[model samples]
Target: MDALPTDPEPTDTRPTDAAPTDAVLDRAAGAVIGSAAGDALGAGYEFGPPLPDDARVGMVGGGTFAWAPGEWTDDTSMAVAVLRALAAGEPLDDDRTLDGVVDAWCGWAVDAKDVGNQTRAVLGGLAPRTAAAARRSARAFHDTYRRSGGNGSLMRTGPVALAYLGDGREGDLARAARAVSDLTHAEDDAGDACVLWSLAVRHAIRTGVADVRVGLPWLPATRRDPWAARIADAEVSRPRDFDRNGWVVEALQAAWSAITHGTTLVDVLERAVRGGRDTDTVAAIAGALVGARDGASAVPAAWRDVLHGWPGLDAAALTDLAARAVRR
Candidate 1:
């Protein structure tokens, strides 16, 4: 692990008169809306299906199997549940939030919808424990199956980051991220990667375009992880050498680079998506960061309309939660 960054001077450039309530609401609204839109947009291409040339084509269309328009899979559904729990005043540091996360997962499973394999296994294994047993057993269960460094844990973490920004609590944000991720992915790398990404997104939203170098000061000091070194290098490098693996470190680097390299939210997301591999997750991650910086107003209107009516989960309700949770 590389050394984590020292706290940099605050770079918030919103109007001095900007109300706290307004800023929070904007950040929250942008987060949920961006997430749903990214999920819906990428749903067409999930599992590696090609995106339609028209782009506006709702269903996958003839000759190709058509998916129902605006349907989000488990990604957005679980995220909505998480957001609802947070909005109900669950604290990230407390056991209650963990229970809320578990409850949310159970609610989603009741619908018999698609779920990630690792997430399903974790949730299924811990369902029978009483609250105390559930907590202890779940932690042990998470520790047992620790190899899931997949983007699933990272995808739904935006709300936690937004909710905890500027609380001045040491490791609170990172801990919150870990609590959410540890529900399914307790691996150190997965949890740490989620924390790093959440912090980057929060920094972007608060400061418009935070220097990625800021993150270098926060890297752990044990092993000289090449991933941390690579990100640190990208923070100071030229445009051509950035890597875009589907790996979490690569995805974080790509998201930061896209923000620094592009002038608009769509440009950043497009850059992230076109990098391929785990394109959807990368795009979703970038979208959260960009959306925080630019707010929901920066997203395209047509995309918002398409996202609003996505099937199963209520995209609008999630957006509403985002709006309500962060309202100053």
Candidate 2:
């Protein structure tokens, strides 16, 4: 294979340094664009194993959703919803902030392709209600699907890091992450996974290294021991060791496993999608972490140039949203 290029792609008007360090903007844009690139790359082969070495892995679309080549799936769409909510100029943990997110989610879900079962159930049922009422409805919905633990929440969590990080407040970041997850997913694991991944993205964007273990201490005592052990084990494991079937625990494990084992953005994304089932979400999750670590410039120009998604966002638009998100 050819070596991955290092030039930054044409996405978003690069954020000015007056707001933050150039590294911050680069990683912020990378987090959003990287997720979309990974989603589009993996979309063509959703629910399937890695292609043969000779087969092209570039975005060709036509998976279960039959998307156009270069188009991202619901993962990027939902994340953008969260980003839009944060861009509304309210505190991340405010009731109005959560309401904005809930509204954006329901609006997106109205015709969203490939919506997750858990998310669809909560949003479809509670979208018309007030945020307080929706939270209650989401809890009841959670009771019915507590054991399933889908990766729906985790897939869109990258934006939370951008919104809440750099404030010198990990607590606010955790609260925002949990709040975002609880909107549609009631399970503790689902919420925990979002916090863990969002914090990892925060650490990577702020520090230029993707370390899944950084957020382990923030987990509740009940989950800390098990999640810590699993993350430690995943760091040395191969991608196939994880069950990439959309469960949040396994999804987190799969993403962290690939990230720890791979040496570069290309290496991480390739290993992520090769696990087969839930390819796009797994790769998108991993992409957010590694992209935050490496910056948007690390994504290949071929993929970046064509990256697009629902709600009419291409790489540039998503980066613009991401830039605005980090500033808020």
> What tens-digit string does per-residue lDDT give for candidate 1 at 1-328?
2354444434333432244556656655776667665555555554453333224323231122233455555666777766776777677777766676677676566554456666666676565432344445545655676455656677777777666655453256666776777676655566666776677666655655544443333446452265567666655642223333344556566566656666777766655554545545666766777777777777787676556432344555666777555542
Q: After superposition, how far is residue 257 of candidate 1 from its true place, in Å?
A: 4.4
Candidate 2 clashes: the total is 0
Measured by lDDT, the strongest candidate is: 2
CA displacement after TM-score superposition, residue 256 of candidate 1 (Å): 3.7
TM-score of each: 0.77, 0.90
Task: Assess candidate 1 and give its lDDT.
Answer: 0.59
In candidate 2, residue 120 scores what lDDT? 79
lDDT for 284 (candidate 1)? 70
lDDT of each candidate versus the true structure: 0.59, 0.78
Model 2 regions more than 4 Å off: 1-18, 50-56, 127-129
